[model samples]
Target: MSPALDVRRPALAHAPLLADPVAAALQAWVHADGVGVAAIDPDLADTAAFVEAYGVASDASANCVVVGGRRDGVERIAACVVLATTRADVNGIVRRALDVRKASFLPMDRAVELTGMEYGGITPIGLPADWLLLVDEAVTLAGRVIVGSGLRRSKIEVPGADLARLPRATVVPGLGRPVG
Candidate 1:
């Protein structure tokens, strides 16, 4: 299938462009099959800069954020995926879904350490099996979306339906609200 972003190349054809875990997942994770990857300047990994530099539509890109909170003195963590044009309702939907009193974005160092990925390049693929994955409904309906490749030097383009099928993923309505 054609990608939402015109610049993507078949991921399997350029495994070196992907991070280790990302490459492994693309090979083994059934949900990531057929996804595309594209090399990009590491300086433009962030959504805004990546979209602008690559001339990709903002809505075609998605962000994966790490969040966590404590309940009954037990910490719980999850990954939230939402379109670049919107922001995850972490304080509301995520906190409730995690069943924690409060939820906050994970510290960069901690997130990077726990996920074994770069701070700005975390993706839902290859995440710890225990971490819940919350994908906004809008993303699943987008047909295709651009996401991190677990590295800053490349991006993955996958069918939105594929993301919804990832292990531990739950499609959440209103998970993301339009950014002001």
Candidate 2:
């Protein structure tokens, strides 16, 4: 395990991917459905590089993006975008979509704390039930996409269509489309 993955979160479980409740639940959900998951020998923080380095199909890489939440003592919404060739123009789309007064990238600690997913490995699976899931339309084009297993060392390669089954996700246009 890389030293950077030592999230050392308080509520984190001592076990691997099952350490966090959300993570554990996520693993259980995928496993129960018999999701065909695979892991890479090397750790990948960058989704694009992970796809290239691991020979993971580009169309099938789900990048777990953590957009800022409505922090009025509650996380109203968090955007989990798929990993593709571009980035999410949060200011233009996410903010307007979530309808929050303001939207920005969540602090690392806050993101880790709220999502229960390790830094450099945040995935949409096993996140808080209340957090709104916004899936980019382009991601549905892939047959399989590698996503975080709520752990840094592990990732789950799941079918693009199946992602919605894990969580009631909301499909949004221009999630990765250029804002300008």
Candidate 3:
């Protein structure tokens, strides 16, 4: 872990949300894969606030968005991860990638309910087994990145390559575009 990340936080296994299978899966993966975790104030969990408060570089932080669409009356969902300086191309790239006519950000309520994680705290580490995980290729190139820890109270610092190794994760070029 880099010096920028606080090492005082409890391991992911000890996090309060571990009782949830999604979170527990993340904890298990982090331990098994050797990722790092940092504690943060739940109140400042939003990306902008967390970055500003902690002096973390925005480029080193990643955001995960859940997108949903339907095809042939069957719903399709995916978790997209992009650097904070970029925006996931849900309507264009993602819709095409998912083979759905239209792809949009999942409703907050539905996302929170399905992922078993709080809004503003969703991470790709422990998504539902059946859901697709899309990671921007640039994210995989980032040496070390900060992402949600399945809870707003902490964050995980992981090598981008490690994130690419996630089961069901696909590294897609142009998955995200630079934000204006």
| Per-residue lDDT over 6-99 for candidate 2, one digit per residue giving the tens place of the 0 to 100 score | 2223112323543265446644674334343334443564675676666655556677787864746655566567646657768777887777
lDDT of 3 at 27: 50
Question: What is the alpha-carbon lDDT for the whole of candidate 3?
Answer: 0.82
TM-score: the better of candidates 2 and 3: 3
Candidate 1, which ten residues in sequence have the lowest lDDT sum? Answer: 1-10
Q: TM-scores for all candidates? A: 0.93, 0.76, 0.89
Best by lDDT: 1
Cα deviation at 75, candidate 2, in Å, is 5.1
lDDT of each: 0.87, 0.63, 0.82
lDDT, candidate 3, 18-62, per-residue tens: 326545675556443466677778898899888888888888999
Model 1, runs deviating above 4 Å: 1-7
Better of 1 and 2 by lDDT: 1
lDDT score of model 2? 0.63
Q: Candidate order by TM-score, highest to lowest?
A: 1, 3, 2
| lDDT against true structure, model 1 | 0.87
Pick the TM-score winner: 1
For candidate 3, report its TM-score: 0.89
